[model samples]
Target: MNELRFRDVSVRFGGRRRGVTAVDRVDLTVPAGAVVGLVGESGSGKSTLARAAVGLAPLAGGAVLLDGRPLPRTPGRHGVQMVFQDPYSSLDPRMTVGASIAEAAPRGGNTTAEVARLLDLVELAPERAAQYPAQLSGGQRQRVALARALAARPDVIIADEITSALDVSIQGTVLNLVRDLQRRLSLSMLFISHNLAVVRYVSDLLAVMYLGRIVECGPVDDVLGDPQHPYTRQLLASAPRPGGIPTALTGAEATLDSAEPGDPHHPPPGCRFHPRCPVGPLVLPGRDDCRDTEPDGAQRRHQAACHYAAHASEQHNTRSTP
Candidate 1:
């Protein structure tokens, strides 16, 4: 089985004065044949982590391991491939769809046969291969991109916001294709998106990132249904329901300001999220722990990084004590 492990990984850019720490000692694993979803706001380092897996982002500390070996600097060199967000830009507008998919085919492989098979795998008609990117719909283009990724015959495919650009209806079709493909091929995937609903749909395991850290990680349903961290609760509360209505989150007001991502160069000290953590007081009780402590990303069952995760547990136990 091929497993992707991020061991104490960190990514820093620029100098001490101007440098930002995009990813901070995050340890995560995508077991073979599983889909792991990473959900976080823009600049939350989710994309940076994805980039690190594909060797696009340099790591300041730690490493990325594929089945106990280091990931190659160039993707698809060792069965690792990435399907980027914008198919329009990722695919060559100048080249025909068949040509693009053929280019990604394994070395020494029969390109024509591979393109036909991949296009069929992604549910595109064989004739569609003759179409150019400009002639295809957004969903069709994405499927073609997926076909291209499959042509590489990768063990792990990093899908970075592949559905974010499509309409909601089209998003579901693409998501279904991804889920079906993963199961059919037994492929491991690291799916990155900010859409909670979409992530919940496609992932078996979910990791929620805040700022540059994974604040929560667990089974998809468990974490989203019974969120342990304050941020998780906040996200659940803020995420829109089907009717286009924001679910009314009790306790803290929903206030995830749509600001540019935080400066990695100067993240707030203590808990990076303490400044906006509404339920911190409820969980931390009478301490300033949240503002002065850094919680390591050690998963305890469905782990959460807040200092008050234990406190909340204790409180729950206390309430249940008979």
Candidate 2:
């Protein structure tokens, strides 16, 4: 097992002065043999952070490290691999699935046997290797993408919304397969998703992002059961319940649609989420902290980048205590 660390990472697109900052000074770690799930709404930079880990996205600041060593800029095989969201686009359309997986095998390895083994590992039939991406269902294609990532023998795998494009019925199967593979292979993973329910199902740790910054992070149970950040609370509230009923947002948490997120090219000076924050000045008239000061990012377990995080936690504890 190998640990992957993103130290104060930032990703900017376009020119220096006019570019948009997709990821802003994020500090996250995928611990050895553990799965860390990064969750957020669309355009919140979850995928950008994943791309930074595998060198797909250039970092404007900070470094991506594997086992305390910086990743090589000129990549051949860096022990870090990514499984993209769209399987059809990720795999070569002209190549056989066998050939696609074989291309990722390390030098001098037996490509034929390697391809079969990978196919079996992902629960696909060995014969499926002879077919093309178009021949496979969305779910199977995603499994092939996972197999391709594994063929690299990577120490860390970044799965960027790998299930979002698939049908809801197939999503569960893929999620189960991914969890099984992680445990059986002892793989370190950074699973990115916009669905809190999906992230909660597969992650050991959970990190929530707003705009380009992480607003809260902690063990899955802690963060989901008692979300300290308002944005996290809103996400949780919007998630469907066990019987497919939507969890209604009430009081301060009901303001998710009151305002849109700020532009990435010119993010708000203070807390980026303040404009739409359910618990900010929109509800608490006298409170201006969210509009004036940036809350500290997650620096410890169960931490949240909100001035009222402690208060919220305390209130929850009080309500739940017997």
Candidate 3:
């Protein structure tokens, strides 16, 4: 089993002085054979992190490690492969599906057989290999993309919003195939998505990102069941619930009227999230701790990078005391 770790990874676009930091000091691990779902809003750096793993994006600082060692920057195959979000654009329009998968196969092998096996691995009909990208449906194209990634025989797969572009009716089928493939192949994955329900269904562990930093991470059940950070609670509250019932967080704290996330090029001081924090100045009024001091990323079984989460835990413990 291979473990993938991002050690304080940071990705900056353009010049260092005025560039936007897409991923900032992110520390995350996809444990051996475990699926870690990364969730956040569209601009939260989830995809940027994935790109960094595959060497598509240059790291401004830090390293991406595979099994405790740094991944090779010069890539043919660094034991990590990425399946991008848009199937329509990800697959080449001119190439046949078989040709696409075979192109990623290791050289000096029976490429045809490998392509057939990969197609079957992704649950595609073997004959579909001859079809062009335009000939396949959205879901089929995605499956082909998965097949192409698998052809590299990678230890870790970075799935960057792989299901978001598919039709709703076909999303479940694709997700199930991905889950099944992971178990059958004992693959470690960093699954990126914005859908809480989808992440809950597919991931064993979850990491929440906001403005290029991880705000919370833990076992999926623990984080989703008892979210620690106010941002996490706000995300959960806004998610659609079964039977149209509201989530545990209700009223003012759950409201989305807080300030919008700041520019990545010029993030706010201290916590970085203080401007939009529901439990900070918005609720506590005179509290400057959130604005004046950056909170360390919580280092525990279930982690949350918010001072208020720690304070709220202390308050709860005090109330429960004799």
What are the runs in model 2 whose C-alpha is more than 4 Å off?
Answer: 74-76, 250-252, 314-322
- Give the TM-score of each candidate: 0.91, 0.94, 0.93
Worst 10 residues of 1 by lDDT: 250-259
Query: Between the candidate structures 1 and 2, which one is better when assessed by lDDT?
Result: 2
Q: How many backbone clashes does candidate 2 have?
A: 0
Q: Write the per-residue lDDT of candidate 2 for residues 14-111, one digit (tens) a residue.
A: 99799899999998889999999999988999998888888778889999999999997544444999999999999999999999999888878678
Give one digit per residue, the lDDT tens place, for model 3 in 180-201.
Answer: 9999999999999999999999
Give the per-residue lDDT digits (tens) of candidate 1, residues 1-322. Answer: 8799999999888888778889999999999999999988788999899988888888899989989998766644547788899989999999999999988886786778788899999999999889899999999999999999888788999999999888888898899999999999999999999899889889999999987888899999988866777667667656888897975533333443332344566777777777676545423466577767886656466888877766554543454357
Give Cα-based local distance difference scores for all models: 0.83, 0.88, 0.87
> 1 or 3, which is superior by lDDT?
3
> Could you give the candidate ranking by TM-score, starting with the highest?
2, 3, 1
lDDT against true structure, model 3? 0.87
Candidate 1 residue spans exceeding 4 A from truth? 75-78, 249-262, 281-285, 310-322
